[model samples]
Target: MLAQIRSIDSNFGRTNGGLNQNLDSLPENEINVKLSGKTKYTDYKIISHKNDTTIVDTTLTIQKEYKFNFLRKDNFELLAFHNQGQTFNNLAYDFTNISQFPDIGFKAKLFNYFDIEDVNYYQVPTPTTEIMYRTGLEQGQVVDALFTTNFSKRFNLAIAYKGLRSLGAYRRSLASTGNFRVSFKYETPKGQYAIRGHAVNQDFFNQENGGLTATSLEAFVNDDPNFSGNRGRMDINLNDAENTFDAKRLYFEHTFKLLSSKDSLQEREFSNLKLGHSFIRDSKFYRFNQGTATTDIFGDANSSGSINNKTSYLLYNNQLFIDFNSKYVLGRFRVKSDLSTYSYGYENLQNNTVGITKNKLKGDAVSFGADWNGRIGNFYVNASGSITPGIGRLSGNRLFGEAFYKKDSVLTIKGRVGISNKSPNFNFLLHQSTYNDYNWENNFAQIGTHTLGGVIESKWGNISVDITNINNYTYFNENSKPVQFSGDVNYLKAKVSKEFILGKFALDNTLMYQKVASGNSVFRVPEFVTRNTLYYTDEWFKGKPLLVQIGATFKYFSKYNANAYNPLLAEFTLQNDTEIGYPTVDLFFNARVRRTRIYFKADNISSFALDKNYFSAPNYPYRDFVIRFGVVWNWFI
Candidate 1:
């Protein structure tokens, strides 16, 4: 009885579940359920049997007046969605598709490995489901689905699936991909321990038509003005080639408090001594197959090597970290150790009469790393470094640091610098293509790169600049053979995005300028690229219940000798002959009604009307002028 009196006297006693039995049970036993439906009604004055005035109300009449820009998806990350410098079906902002293969690099040759953008999984209390469907070029279609739910406040699970199938607009061009992911997050009620994990499997199958034949490309450019209209009739270099990239991965990270925070009961803070462990097991397979083998097209085709080539890679990694975070200047610090084993290359061949041993690699490496990050007032800084100790030939060493300052949403700035010295992909060192067009065994030195970049953003717009220097930049030359540049190459790139809104009209523009300060002979980049949009927005009706927006986008890039793509190698190779550049125009109208959004767009509106050249990749023409319609509906069920 005395305890009850003490608890009742305090306002927080209701939440303490102390001696108040009735209050404690009542709070926990109550359940919440909700549902909603809407309808709209119109009233007419009977003057000429037409409605004169319109009024919208939430209680009496539901209004379908929600409105949004049709080009909302093209707002900021437009560069990525555009895939400006890549082949069709490729991701954007991936102009440089070249990177050192992972230490355990075994996978089917890939053109879009660096292009895939993984999902950002989140843990939430409410259940969420999102479904999207889209049409492709010809017989293409995209379907996506994701679902996340929390069984308890401290635990949640999520699953996501995606399927893409595109027959493409050209002959013998097609792609089919399936991606599945499952993830879970858990935390202790006391917030002392937590774990997050995800497992993903992706299968990408692409038909390698080897693009169109040279004569066909010539006809497309000069001989035939309406070539794009009959894209299905174009002659291709190789029609039987197909590449499949398959991968599976499992990752998990868990952290447990080593020392409890002093305010653990009253409040929770991540600042404390903690121990963490992470594990990863990943594998990849890449295979290229051709039904009718032809040695004539690819030099080594008929030479005892069937037109089937495959590669596989496996990796197992484990990491441990001891971390400390404190409010007192120590901010946060982490000491980490990693051990990984990798196996790559072909295990067995269907036929290897070439008298060559199976090109294979297997190794183990151990690395040590440390990192620190802290925030002081309006400024924040972070730094990290790692080094490998004679575990494998690959030098897994890296150093990076960055600082950021932000006063409010209006003024924000960030600068970062980093360098990585790493070995080339094992596949790059010893590659065997069943097709004779490409075959090599390179003994190249490890490459290193230094990068300095900064970004500034404000209410007006944002700007970013970067400077990069690469020693021994690796790339495929005109000969379709992988080569490393001996000298250092320097590149400077800057991008700016500015938007002006006056009354109901708005204009947005983004421009990128790139320069090769040195080693122009080896490095390549366009001089300039830009995208601009002009739009107007307004609302109608007495209640302004209906909103509408219409806009048009313009994209342009300077003419340059864009790299040619080799389907067999899944690589973009240097080409000096053809320079591709042209301006593209698109018009769009988008609207939101209630919670639903609909968009209509006409891409490449001036295609045949203009002789401008538009190609996603060499010999691969861009999509012709076409109109598309799409809708997005969100449900909170």
Candidate 2:
């Protein structure tokens, strides 16, 4: 049998009457407790019974926390216990439970219906002039609508409307009428103010058998049998007529913003004030007829009767204008100014069926300008001039100048000069009533122009050149008569663009060259043109999202013949006479979400065929295939 025991206890006391017993036993591998030399674990036990050599005490406490798991790789254990002379102070343990993460997703989604703070959309497709006898799709469709608001951050508001319609084939007409525009704005920290108003009412209609057709009649070889018994006969016929036109306009505007600033010796500065007013009214009407002919009548061959020539027209134009502008800077000088004043009145009317009212025509004009800019370090300068005055026309002057040299990141050099005067157009100076009974008078034409230029820009590219007389060296005949053809127009232009980065894609390449002058050719010039673009961007496809752009365009024009006269009896002709080269290619796509945006575009992808020659309509081939879809949304409240 075997037994092993070890115990130890110590006590020294002084008391009276207290039972106590003391015992100590040790020996389990020679129990030892030599403090400070590091020897522990003396298998132990202690007992004490005393009387007069006694001790009296009381103690009770309990505290327990145990979490232990250590069965290998990287252990962790904690055990605590206190009971029996419990003494434990200020002890703590906290290891805030670990493990969390999951959330990163959103490709596209967020457009919870209607709240497009401010939006303005515009579309203009002006192509309508096919009324020789009307058959379908003849120019007339103008639409615009605008909406705006900001009711509480300094009040602002806007509302606009415009509509026009016309589709013809014999009759599907409602020509010009519809308009409403309104605006009000007020913002101030020291700037911005606006008040605008507009109103328009227009109705114009013309259909009196709509133009030209009178089969036969021609006589004039000194014919006079006492005025030919046909009452002062001077005959030529073939015309069918119908006409109506009407108009009305009213406008008012007030704008002001005085002194906006940015300075470091003037980076930018502005001052503005505008005031306006307008009112206009116009009217026109015509009806004339005389046709029922198949004659051999010195008197009568089969005598058919129908001859009526009626006339009606009423016209008026009243205009008023007052405009002013300003810009500022000082200390390297920069200044600009503009002024305007106009008042006009005109009236003409003839209503015959014996209701007599006639008073033919009248006139007006006045204008002004000023400009300046300066710098002397990298050399920069500009100067300007202007004047215009009229009553019966011709009182004009204009002058301009420029000089430049810049080098901050390499080269720039420039030069410019100009002189000008021009006037003509009051319906070529009113001479009315003709159905081929010829009557014309009142013609005035004036023009004087000159220009010279130069430019060179670089970071590595740009060049421009010019020379002009532009219809002023000579060529006159609006009754000033004397035309044998004179010419002088010269232009040479060059352009280049470059930017490259290929890994994440961003590239732009452009080249353009235009040269004209070898007997003057410049009417929609496109001697050569080129373009290229490739772009890509990303930031997680939404918010700071993706973008892509692709491009291609190439055009070369040498087709010439928008003749002012005799490009084959030209009343404006350019319906193919050989030399033509027009090319076009384009594609665009855009998308975004989290504020919504989408766009897609395609334009004349080599379907290029446009033979537009309109000096007032007709010579058409601007084919079509245009589709547009749009959406944009943004709002915060």
Candidate 3:
């Protein structure tokens, strides 16, 4: 008989375009296998678009995914898995632009492990898991091919072609990446030597124009015929009215390492050294053409336009490290120290013909750091610090230290503190030029700032808090004048979590609070949110597995000055002062059967509606009462 159960998992519930939850688990000495598949239906309607009256039609989407996996296996074992997903929207708009040409990609891996005896080793397992190991060389390959019509538009289309070879795993062994690399090592009685190299290339392109809004003569008048001399004639003449862009990147790297060790009566230790260098270059071009003009409410005339921008960037980096370990007092007390240095330089250039703007940015930086760890009796301490100097330096100096004490099985205490400085990026300093007659600039008064935080943990539970400030601790001049702003412009956060078990049932709870102080009246921190969940597992129907879980979340936002920026509205100056309604609550339930899992989730179960404080794009609406149901399955061979 096969066990089938309903399982519920916790998630942040924040839709940020990435996987919703962390899936990595500690290594175990068990052969676990899973196979699952799922299909889902989604209905989306644009409720409001920044006060716009143009109602976006409703659309429905259908999607599916399949996956499989095998874990913690011995030598000669095999694990294989694949995922396929498709989405269909009613708007005649292939959600994935299959007509414009889309592509399918896959990756696979196979490895054999061997153990060496008669070799002395020191192992330190992680507190969360009993596994003690480091990542090393692993071999794999990836292949991708796109169909010509995958992303086809009515007037244009695009296709992608690429392949990659991979070798050697990094700290997070299972992470997906596109670099092919090799490593070699030589050892002797006196010391050890090692070298490594990596190279990778990727290319992509797409052309889409069908379904675009019609262009008008007013938009054509703003077009720049002589945008750039280096651009090909075809690029300059392309309609590009549909806002399209394509890009590609290539990377290469090389590294070296050497170590030495010896034994003595007072202390026995090993000193290891490592060095690495890498060079990379990237280029990208995007074009957006406007073919129409639209009028706005305030009698302001807005014309449709297109833009083409290209940028090329290059980077060089070097790193060196040394490690030393020693023991004294009959091998009771142990000490370990490590030091590293890194330096990097980068240059970038961006050219835009639509705005007739050419921008160049260059910067170089260097950083050095050292860490020391000591263990005496049942107490252990670790300390580290680093300083970085550079033109666009985001972080100048950073220091972190931690201490942990364990007294048998009775209790354990752990604490850590850290402080650091940061600098702003080029985009924050350089303004964008959209139209020939339109120019905007960032009015930032500060270059960078600092942050400090600490954490404490014990068997009972764990708690952490951090505070960060930008421009409050430092000051800089903009446009030959000292700029000043109101508000502390700082952020504070705290979190705590613990787990409990009751017979066959398990419960976990976590609490978090965050607040951001200072900033322009138009920008404010999101409301405070809290979530709770309960889970139960039981055997049913002759040992068939059964699990059920349910959860709920609540969000509260204090009425603040909603009209702080409006010159005509003086009644409300702060968000907290506004007369807002009650908080919102959401509920969800999930179940699983072997490799198959299902989810039933609802957002804003109370049917509450509110405007979002932030906007990623114009004419985008915020929605409430979003209900979703999904299922997934996996298979392995």
Candidate 4:
């Protein structure tokens, strides 16, 4: 199925893919078929859908998802919710996977509350099934399953589900999430008509233990000589605070050919004109509960500890699109236009207990946008733009363009820039938390961002740099309150990665540098972050069927005041006074036997032998020293 276009109006929609593995490169067999067939098309594997001849760049290489590359690549950065789950890092360097839709410029996001790694769309060639399960120290757990089958050469169906439960290393910090998706694709034998659809449901539950309430940080950071290892003995801010966010979505789209052409010599046919329609319905709900211990209030004068607040939002969107493809001066060219309308906002809400004066935000808009992709020999370029004039007080937009060149497999260089103006997510704009330390609705302003970046890659290693400027930046402040800045903010980031090899020994290193040029008072980032892995790998056993590698990675971040996570709001907000830094090292051994992958790991190895202040967020401590083992197996049924 083609990668369906995600709308900004859809609650629980996807995010930007900057830190994700580059999905632009097609599989070897697919690339051969595309060039030989003299035609190009888009599929679900990549984040974007295209219909022109574009070279798939395979030069971008990413390390395995199991390791820690500043948490963006880690399997279980925070409490796991599969891949792309929540992570505790500075907001300035946080990786976003969600992209804004060209339609009504609005989104209902709970990114920190739930994560769905694979994006739930792919081409299933045959009947296949996969089952995964993992359990960690301190009552941590995970379970997942997937099944796909081809009913016919032109039709396929897939269903996937994931469940997670983690009683965090600290007391009263349990988190659980459940996600399920069902997808289907069908195309006519002539490839003139096609249809794709999917239904998804995701739910997240977390206990809001408001970090440590101790006045002095040392009370929780240091360990006494006689103290045994019991994490529950530490004091926490709030134990009764709990929150849950849930999303349900049903989507369907179909397209048909309006004009067609065929080549006599090559026995090839193409659709020069096509029309399509799509429908999506998404519903979201956030609930928070607190008991008696919350009576004595803090943080705000109008709030108390014991409270109950819950709210729900329902959205419906319909879209129509036209696509054209042919040869033009710019090379093989394709352009597409879309028109969409949406109805969204809260249908029902609780009282002042939720902290917002308005119960619902409802509006509709007519949005249109276009995209073009072309290639001339080895050089290629693509551009896209979208806008809305604001129908009844609702408006937002996006503009993006990029170009790249690659010389065979040895080296590649690319650069891109984009500008977008998006309204803050509905969840943050109106949050209803029970904790006295968490509750908000201050009428946040819209956010505009301008970003420019470049990448250089080769067999030896890769280097990347980015410069971003933000207007009206939005975030949670030190008081754990949601707010927006009116001043322009600038962020500079650069990354370098390389590996040294000698015989069977290899050392992989990655270093990142970040700086806040304008709004340094609110925009915070670590000056330096580094990760190094030292390991040995070789083949052993009969016929060398088993391949094993053992290694240890030292992860370090320069001392900085990392933003703290608020469970009630499901966001990482600024914490100017909460300075924390420590080295977190992990030791692991992994092996691949046939198609199965297995690993045994010791997380936070250094913490087991020394007394150091190691915090994942401001007051929350990193996972205690623990031993873990897990395996992944894929099957074709």
TM-score, per-candidate, Cα-based: 0.82, 0.20, 0.49, 0.83
What's the lDDT for candidate 2?
A: 0.31
lDDT string, candidate 4, 194-303, tens digits: 88777889887777777776643465455643233666676777878777778888887777777767656775543266677878777777766677445343344234
Name the better of 2 and 4 by TM-score. Answer: 4
What is the C-alpha lDDT profile of model 3 across 93-120, one tens digit per residue? 0011011000110001101101111011
Lowest lDDT sum, 10 consecutive residues, model 1, at 43-52
- RMSD in order of candidates: 11.9, 43.3, 18.7, 6.4
* lDDT of candidate 1 over 179-213, digit per residue (tens): 78887767788767877777888887777777668
User: What does the lDDT read for residue 219 in candidate 2?
Assistant: 22
lDDT of 4 at 380: 57
Q: Model 4 reaches what TM-score against the true structure?
A: 0.83
Worst 10 residues of 4 by lDDT: 6-15
Specify the highest-lDDT model's number: 1
lDDT per residue for candidate 2 within 535-590, as digits (tens), equals 55344444544433333323333333322211000012222332323444445454
lDDT order of candidates, top first: 1, 4, 2, 3
When summed lDDT is taken over every stretch of 10 residues in candidate 3, the lowest stretch is 83-92
Instruction: Give the residue spans of candidate 1 off by over 4 A.
Output: 1-117, 223-228, 263-270, 294-297, 303-306, 349-358, 540-546
In candidate 1 the C-alpha lDDT for residue 236 amounts to 85
| Strongest candidate by TM-score | 4
